[model samples]
Target: MTEKNYLTQKFEADRSRLRGVAYRMLGSLPEAEDAVQEAWLRLSRADTSGVDNLSAWLTTVTSRVCLDMLRSKKSRREDALLEGGPEPSVSGEDAIERETILADSVGLALLVVLQSLNPAERIAFVLHDLFDMPFEQIAPIVDRTPDAARQLASRARRRVRGGDVLDTAQTAQKSVVDAFLLASRTGDMAGLMAVLDPSVTVRVDAFAGGGQSRELQGADTVANFYNGLAQTARTALVDGAIGAVVAPLGKLYVVLDIRIENGKVVEITAVGDPDRLASAEVSVV
Candidate 1:
């Protein structure tokens, strides 16, 4: 440990907090890890001699990195509109059990609420309210004036405080999850197709699938994959959202997390490591 570079060691120390910020910004564990890794890469390649507040600098950089990713996602959706195909689902099933260990700790309510906000509002509110970051540093990352950033946070704050957005997102999430599970249990391929987007993606753990491709895309492909799925899996509250769990004899062995957009399932993450699944607190809503 002593032989490690001081910069590297310092980063390791802040890794937990940095990851928390990223996770809240992007609800998906895989995406949050990606953002944190991108931030570390940026720090290693840039000159930081002039940096005084290292923590603040890292926060700003990570926020910018997440902002760019979010904008890229929006751009892809627009391009997809013109191309006449929905955007490809970005799905990965790795380290989710670890990444989401803090999901509830970070306030699942806020995560659901933040999901409804535009990118800028999400960043502004997360940095200012959650992390106590001043709007001055946040403004540049969002490309808005400090006051404007504050106003964005204010608007987001109102919505969050009102709880209307949270209810809506949670309700929508639960409905989709229920529909998917019902279709799977009943082996209704067409029913499964109804709730899945054309570009739907299914990702399962490599260990679970015995070296299979681990990723299946397209509504038809994924729907077929689950047409006669397990009857054991039942609706459960996953990380404070309505998802599903597969277990036998009262021991959780599989967990599914879905990304629903416009009332359709676009991405699905399935984790089946017995240890990780058992570690998850599966509850009924």
Candidate 2:
């Protein structure tokens, strides 16, 4: 094959992997594709005669693109934001199976936390923890030393690990989360009513829907909606508090950040934004 053809073939092989990295970094499918295409553009224009590892180079370039995109997200996120279509209804065994598959991927709560991170921390964590890249190589992408990169990953790791809710001492909070999960998984309306306060409120992030479900209120209103619908949810610590994480296959799909008072759930905030979900730390049940 000619030199140009050889380069094209090599880049195509790495495109999917590069796209995965960008998706994890940006949390948006369209943006991830953009980043990957940008990497292709850079590769097309640059000289790689001395490059030892094409995969590594592509990852760095894609990461840089995502970092720039993330840095500029404040203005872009509002305009480009989108969420899943209306949540599909599943019953009995179907819900269980769907949850299991989704859990196998990244948990939604974790994504929320990842989104909360600065560009450097996000890239450092995604490369080192998710993609298994070495800090030595990750350092340059974030303009940090290898040691600094390692520290960034460490901080991100610590946050990913469960927090105070992991403590057995927080029994009351745990009980609330447990009740919520049991009710959700069992589709028990009575159980939901028993645990939720009369004035309970449920609010999902804007990406969930800029309208109606944006804010669902009243214990009956919220419980009626959630009852028998969260078959995949499990008790977990979300951001140091007791709550539920919907991850059937171990990947985060949604984070139910709950607030309980007097042994009853008073508030539940569901965050579905991928960038925000990356930052949430959900404890294993």
Candidate 3:
């Protein structure tokens, strides 16, 4: 086979693995495809005669594309920026089915926890822990020394494993989270208030669809926001803290990262960002 044909054949062979890496790095399907396509584009245009491993080269390129996309997602005007591209030929239902399978395969709770991490930390952790790449290879991709990259992965590992050993304090916190979720699901205003500090706060990230990040202070305001809302929310552990995951029809909609102090919930952060969610390690309570 000619070099051109040979390259095309090899790329097709590596596509699935590359897509998996991109998807883990970017929780959104469309974004992951875009990252992979960008990698293919680079491979097609660049010289690879001296490259030792085509798969490794492609992974690095895809990772850099994903990292850039993750960093830019915050400043983008809308999710529609991704939607503006040529629509995939697949039918809508087929697309949904594929997404559902992918989400299940990757685990929504894990995605939610990954979303809580910073971009560098998420990349380091995913590459090192999930993909089995070494820190030496990850260091340049994240613009850090090998040791620094190791530190980043180490920190991410701790956060991923943070909720594993729940001590007395965590147990009590879980009770508080359970109470809050039950009350919210049942629409029990009084019960919800009982578990919330008078000075409780709720912060919703912009990805939750208000066009901006929102904050609600005081028990009354926070309780009102959650009232009649968590009907579909289920109890879960988010980064070792008692929290809730709102996954309707098996697709993760939101993650409520809760914090409790002195037996009452003091803070709640609701996140819907896909990339951030991809980094989190969540589990059923």
Find the candidate with the highest TM-score and give its number. 2
Q: What digit string (tens of lDDT, one per residue) describes model 2 on residues 1-285? A: 876678778877887677668767876555666677777677777899999998889899989889999988831222231232111234578655544443335554555456656789989999999999999999999999999999998887776665323455467788887878788778888998999899888888775444334788898898778878787676667666777876534446777888888888899888778886776655543
Q: Please, what is the TM-score per model? A: 0.51, 0.65, 0.62
Which ranking of candidates, highest lDDT first? 3, 2, 1
lDDT of 1 by residue, 36-153 (tens): 6667766776788899977788888888888877767631122212122112233544364564456646554455556657899989988999999988888999999999999999
RMSD of each: 15.1, 8.9, 8.1
The Cα error of candidate 1 at residue 81, in Å, is 34
Candidate 1 has which clashing residue pairs, if any? none
Using lDDT as the measure, name the better of candidate 1 and candidate 2: 2
What does candidate 2 score on TM? 0.65
Count of backbone clashes for each model? 0, 31, 13
Give the per-residue lDDT of model 3 (tens digit) for 170-239: 7787788878888987889999999999999888999975669998999999888888888656667765
Which residue runs does candidate 3 get wrong by more than 4 Å? 74-91, 167-235, 238-241, 248-285
Candidate 1: 10-residue stretch with minimal lDDT? 75-84
Residue 91, candidate 3: C-alpha displacement in angstroms: 5.5
